[model samples]
Target: MLLELKILFARQAEQQLLQTTRDFHSCKQEEGQLVSSYVLKMKGYIDNLERLGHPVTLGLVLGKIINELHAMLKLYEQTLPKNNAPALHVIRAVKVKKLNKHKKSQPQMAAMGQNHGKGKNREVYAPKPKIPPPPKREDPAKDSICHECGETEH
Candidate 1:
């Protein structure tokens, strides 16, 4: 009975470790999430796996972190030492540049209002030019002419 219980406990630990590993592998940093928080989240999964009796190497964790980070951070990855564990503090401290998301072609949606210092009120307004409507088309029946028979109607 003791041996059976031990096996069951070990199997449960192994299952937990597997689930933790899967979670860690599938973990991805969401948009606007800070690098520190992202690293900490990954560390949490690694810690849980370690506690479950499945040991993960520092190098493997480092690789996983680098792989999961934005491609823009690839330049920073090259700077890390090949063999040693990555410095989480330094990685978290480094600010990853976010892509400029604003479209240049988009028109400004709102104009700023101005306040006048004097008691007299003067409203400033920008007038938009009105677009002229397209010219009306002539009747197709009236305009139709067939040159082959020299006839006004087909």
Candidate 2:
């Protein structure tokens, strides 16, 4: 009976160790989560593993952190401009409108035939007007000559 009990306890300990190892390996930093918090969470897992008689090397921890950071950098790069251009140029290149939650409910009201009046007096949904881009100004140096040098460069 004593030998059987010892074997059962050993098997349980092994299973717990395996589960802890799996948890540590599968941990990942979520989007918008702070790096410090992610690191601390990983540290907790590492501590648990250590308590379970599993030794974690510093190199392994560092490698996992570096790999995760690299992945996050790649994701950030995908959202930003690739070229070394001014942010204004990027903003001007894309035209995006903010979506209003209330605007969506308005369409549903229209679909349900909630017209306030008949014919000309009925409420009609008009598409929002597009905003025109700002007027471009010509460079003064391109048309004006320098008083001392007689050149357009200023």
Candidate 3:
């Protein structure tokens, strides 16, 4: 009975995965469809545009795309996911990840040097770093050293 349920779940998961891929493809197409329709309409306007040659047509088409993108951004801003906090959080997280890819990070560690900063080497499969070590003495036998002879007085 347990095996049957497991098989059933596996089948369902496979089906859902196939359906998810299908839906994702369809969603991409839907977004494209909106953009393409705008592009086609822009094409139509360009075709009939008079007293203007290739450059004007290209500019007009590009301007139309920009307008479409601006409008889409506005719509997205206004109708962002609100309820179903988990789904909204997931969506926002994905958006943040996507946005982060375009951003620059702080100064890289490689600039520090090979095995940089005295034993601060690259971690292979370790967890987070620990606390800083305590300060050490500059010269342990400073008191025993003679100032005149530059030797240990003891």
Candidate 4:
């Protein structure tokens, strides 16, 4: 459960990092500097998380990092300039947006086996073909008998 939450958080962070990279690249030189720096910090965290094979530890670290960043964002809000963004503010905004998106994307229960274990060959579960209900029982009056032999089917 904790692991599921953590993986979701990490994925959201990854998406935000990508978004920040795009936004930073779009900004003017001075403005872009902060975005780039923020992107680097986030990329480091993301890369570490990606290399993990399990979710529990990665999720805990990411959750802690996320909370710390939230705190830092509030504490450093004023660090941003009126016309230019500060590195903290850019990263904080990206983190907030990414976490929100992460919440929305993840299912309530952790996916059964989204991560770990070498995948195996398996048969698909297509439903069996339907067979029509057995034909209605024959009635002597409604069913015809064989003309000569009088066999039931005939």
Candidate 5:
């Protein structure tokens, strides 16, 4: 009887572990959720998993956080105007794994035995400079011209 009871308890523990693992894997940040709250929720799942004898690495947690943040940023971009988009600096500081390639890589001509005058030889990524829009002309008469009707006053 004691052996049977022990086996039942072991089965129950295994089931609990499985459920916890499922919960951890299925956790996702909902739309419009704050980043801090999402991270806290994930941390809670991590804690639960750890308590259930499953170990999660710090790297895994951080990667998960970054992935969620990246997804949120993309969603935000679609809804927000181009001018309101998040700055590249913030994303770079977060060290997100992937970014849209804005600038093409070009090989620089360098002389032999010279490291381009820089201490280290490495590729640098920089955001493209923003150019202001051309100034608008203030000719009301010119603006009033209609090609189809040939009328200066609409």
Candidate 6:
């Protein structure tokens, strides 16, 4: 009876280990997924696999993380540590620092890079035309030409 129980327990443990391994291998970061959350989920699987007597190495976890990370996190791919928590912290720190720096200068950089000639900076009004006033109408009786001669009367 004791031997049978040990065998059954061992088989159940083996099956659990296999399932955990599958979960770890199949885990991947979704589009726009948070890196911290993804890393934490993987770590949870690793912990479970460890509990089932399956060893999960730091390097293996790191490789899985690198494979599953989004393209935006690629910059830190070569530099991240092999361990889990520290790697998550460093990635978050780098991303936050980069975002803050970018936010401060993004508008100015955009304005400098784009052509504003026909954009929002374009002039809205054209110059007005200069026109002369009409001359005052002359009084015919007060300042008129003489009928007999081609001369003006005082």
Q: Write the per-residue lDDT of candidate 4 for residues 19-124, one digit (tens) a residue.
A: 6545433422233346456546655555544544323356654564566456555655666564465445456556765665555443433376553333322222
Over the full model, what C-alpha lDDT does candidate 3 score relative to the true structure?
0.55
Off by over 4 Å in 2: 81-154
Q: Number of clashing residue pairs in every model?
A: 0, 0, 0, 0, 0, 0
Pairs with backbone N, CA or C atoms under 3 Å apart (clashes), candidate 1: none
Clashing pairs in 5: none
- Cα lDDT of candidate 5 equals 0.72
TM-score of 3: 0.32
lDDT of each: 0.69, 0.74, 0.55, 0.54, 0.72, 0.72
Q: Mind sharing the TM-score for model 4? A: 0.20
lDDT of 3 by residue, 7-100 (tens): 9987976665565444322332235467777556555444433312323445655765677677787776667665434555556566766665
Candidate 2 shows a clash count of 0
Question: How much is 25 displaced in model 2, in angstroms?
Answer: 1.3
What TM-score does structure 2 among the candidates reach? 0.50
Candidate 1 wrongly placed segments (more than 4 Å)? 72-154
Model 1: per-residue Cα lDDT over 1-154, one tens digit each: 9999999998988888888988998898877788899999999998898888777899999998987775537655676675453354334333221111332322332233333323223222333558999987577766678768767745
lDDT string for model 5 (1-154, tens) is 9999999998998998888778777888887778788888889888987887877999998888788788777776677665555565455534432421434433453545454646433434445788999998788776787989888867
User: Which lDDT value does model 4 have at 91?
Assistant: 66
Ranking by TM-score: 5, 2, 6, 1, 3, 4
Error of 1 at 48 (Å): 1.7
Candidate 3 residue-wise lDDT at 96: 62
- Model 1 C-alpha lDDT versus the unseen true structure: 0.69
**TM-score against native, each model:** 0.44, 0.50, 0.32, 0.20, 0.53, 0.44
Number of clashing residue pairs, candidate 1: 0
Winner on TM-score between 1 and 2 is 2
- Which candidate number would show the highest lDDT if scored against the true structure? 2
Give the alpha carbon lDDT tens digit for every residue of 86-125 in model 2: 4544343332222222234455656888744554333334
Better of 4 and 6 by TM-score: 6
